[model samples]
Target: MNKIHIIGLGLLGGSFGLAARRKFPELTITGFDISEKNLKDAEVLGIITEAKENPDSDTDIILLATPADSLGDILEKTLNEIGENTLVIDLGSTKSNLCARAGNHSKRKQYLAGHPIAGTEYSGPKAAFAELLDGKVMILCEMDKTDLHLKEKAYQLFEALNMKLRFMDPEEHDRHLAFVSHLSHVSSFMLGKTVLQKMEDDRNIFDMAGSGFASTVRLAKSSPSMWAPILTENKENILQALDGYISNLSSIRDLIAKSDGEKIHQELADINKIRDILDLGRG
Candidate 1:
């Protein structure tokens, strides 16, 4: 009953295996990855006990950690391979599309859609750590559609990682994440591009950069392969988020051009209220 098979041995998959292993040592874990090197690396690193060719017939749970775009195909393939008793969960960032696919599966009650609201700007199995999920929030979408027993097992698995659980609708999850997570990544990538282009003409630009610059541009280091699909999958809500962000930037630029010092002060003061709610620590 403790056998678990994980597909896509990347950062999230590897992290889950490591976390689960440390917390539940008796469980047997196996994994599969499109990159065979990653599958082998995960096994060699003790993240998983072995490499899985397909979803294990006797596995109690299967975790899919592939990119958002490939989630539906992977989910479908795994559903065809696994038995009805096996529980499957996806850790993709986008939820609505994946949840929709799960809802139509013949073994739909055995599937669960989850997004762990935690990760660093890193990818691949080497980026995994046993404490990556500790105390992070795990959002389980469309819980009402999942079977009660599989839901209970998922809750236990997350509990073993010391994660907090939140239940939400899939579309609601996508809309909220587009503004908070997706928009932040898009902003970081753009900021990095702008600074890097400026640095080409001024070598001293980065010499003047501080921790603030590093922190703000950190997400720019994230895997393009991972983010490209996430942005594409959440396009609509992310487009709306971009519109709001761009409007704010245009407003600020206009104020600066007009030398509206008093207006700028008021605008900045209004934005500072966000700090009161967020523990960004001196941002």
Candidate 2:
């Protein structure tokens, strides 16, 4: 049986372990985590056959499931330990940096940079579920850097997990993710912060928080430690997106202040067309 070693057994890693084991019972799975609590939780949930503090154990594949900021360091150490036959893949949000860092390594051809665009506003082992990656998109960045055999291995694994695969350059991945994913996280976090600040005196947040508010602020519940580094890493593109969003908000507010009904109606109508373009349900 092939052995799969998962480092940093948090939500992403833990979920992968569970899903992989459920789908491929022949594979032996082991998990390693820096946090003892996370390791205990993974063991309790049967996400892995065993939990280890060291990642140097023998395994056919190593999944670096650490935060975006910590990926480089973990990859450096993991490369030093794993055999050439072991394929290393990272489940990180920001891929450009990690890809560059691993580019010149001796085992670079064995490493694949992957980002599964599937997660919840939660973290840690207990937050993992077997269905987390089901029907979601998995972005594989800079695949050319990986050997053909390793790439095929990764593709098959993600397919077995029921995820759709998409190829992307690392730089392009970061740029596009900044708008679609990172910006959403920022908007959600700031929205929640703004509401909380207002509620300091109002104390009626729950009253005003209908489904709309809940949906908009959902990502705010994400782990700050996980998001902070991602936002910082993709700061350039995120800043540009934020500027445009703020400018639009200011324009809308000014229109409302001036009571320019015609202009406001026109502006909303123009933007509402997005529902048609994106195939979203009626607003």
Candidate 3:
């Protein structure tokens, strides 16, 4: 890509700029964010070559890393502004709504619905790092709708970043992420809330906390502005996931209350088997 435009200069967008610049030093990277400081910081950090108020049509790639709720309108408007060959990719957490908005657009083929399953529970340009995307998975939805050449361009860029690629239907993508991704954030946030509520009564509570507690609640530190829209956009799927999670929690709660050691042991043992499926270090 000769010219790349990033709409959001936060963590993911800034990281993409850093990584893209690392791989293609000659390319011009321009960024735009609602927060002017983010654009300024991104430029200062050399994450992008410059900052812009609007995307230029001559750009080869436009990465939409905006909040989930704002993606649909931004994407539609971007498609309207870009050249016929410009490729647009969104890194929103939820996909179904934005994919639906692009479904019948004349320039739909130029846009790709994507989610990079990577990030720390941090926000802003300062939190971005080039290696954040290395070895991470980039999930692309509605790939069949993207133009062949644009898809190849996206694939080349992702491969250059050492990312693994996965494709899924937009509906299926939202459903699966609701369970594996979104639900975890909800759980973490609530867990942190519970602990903070207790800490209000006994400020020393954290004195007894350990690394395990810190790790478990780390996602609670994530930006509410970014997550609120994600949760709302995938409301139906997230609600179903919450139901399943609540049922599981209730079962464990009942087991503990009844002093059913055997059942509790069995439940934990069954859950531990998940380690065989996932390697925490890799993720």
Candidate 4:
């Protein structure tokens, strides 16, 4: 019976624990977390066999579910007690920094940096669900640094959870994710902030929020403590994406200001084609 240890039993980690336990009932999962409440919740929910305070527990796989900023320190600390066959993987948003930090370590071969392109606007053990990672893409970055055997183990684990796996270099992953994932978070947060400010003056405005607005603003409810470090970790790529987005907004603003319907129409026509490319069905 192989033992799997999850270092942080939050939504992502807890979901993994649940899926793994369901898929491989013989495997024992030991969860560790700083929060006693979170650990208690995970135990009550049957996400793990037990919750412990020490990271030195015996396990074949260690999943670090801490925030992006705390990954390096946690990885280093856990490496001290990890067995040579024990594979350690982090489910952090940004990868380049964590990859670089773990690359030169003596136990680098045991570490795999991964970002599962799946999550909800929630956190903690209570928010976990078995189907969270189903039909989602799981990106494995900097695989070259991880041992081949351990990489195979990771692939099998994610596959069992019904996730599609993709490989890419850490730098490329960070740059692409800044646009597809990180920027969406920022946009959602700002949209919520703007709408909340407006609602202060017009309380009834919130009642008018449609499905589109709700869909776009859903990520605004994400945990700030989890997101703040991710935004900061991939700051450079995020800033570049923001600059381009702001420039596009300025162009639209100029057209609206002059009432230039022709240019505005053309601009929207070009942008609307994205729906076709993205395969968004007709509303």
Task: Name the TM-score of candidate 1.
Answer: 0.96
Encode model 3's per-residue lDDT on 38-147: one tens digit a residue: 88899999988878867777888999998998899999989988888889999999999889989989999999999999999999999999999999999999889999
Compare candidates 1 and 4 on lDDT and give the better one.
Answer: 1
Q: Write the per-residue lDDT of candidate 1 for residues 1-283, one digit (tens) a residue.
A: 4889999888899999999999888999988999988988998999999887776688888999988889999888888777877899999999988887778778888899999998999999999998999988899988888899878888889998999899899999999999889999999999999988998888884353675888899999999989999999999999999999999999999999999999999999998998776775334
For each candidate in turn, the TM-score is 0.96, 0.94, 0.96, 0.95
**Best candidate, lDDT-wise?**
3
- Please give the lDDT score for candidate 1: 0.90
- The residue-level lDDT of candidate 1 at 47 comes to 92
Task: Give per-residue CA lDDT, model 2, range 1-283, as digits (tens).
Answer: 2788899888899999999999999888888888888888899998998887555455778898988788999898888887767789999999888888898898898899999998999999899999999988899987888888767777778889889888999999999999889999999999999988998889754554666998999999999878999998888888998998899899999999999999999998898887775664233
The models' CA-based lDDT, in order, is: 0.90, 0.87, 0.92, 0.88
Q: What is the lDDT for 88 in model 3?
A: 95
- Which whole-number lDDT from 0 to 100 does residue 173 have in model 4? 96
Error of 3 at 270 (Å): 1.4
Which scores higher on lDDT, 2 or 4? 4
RMSD per prediction, one decimal?
A: 2.1, 2.3, 1.6, 2.2
Model 2 / residue 84 / CA error / Å: 1.2
Top candidate, metric TM-score: 3
TM-score winner, 2 or 4: 4
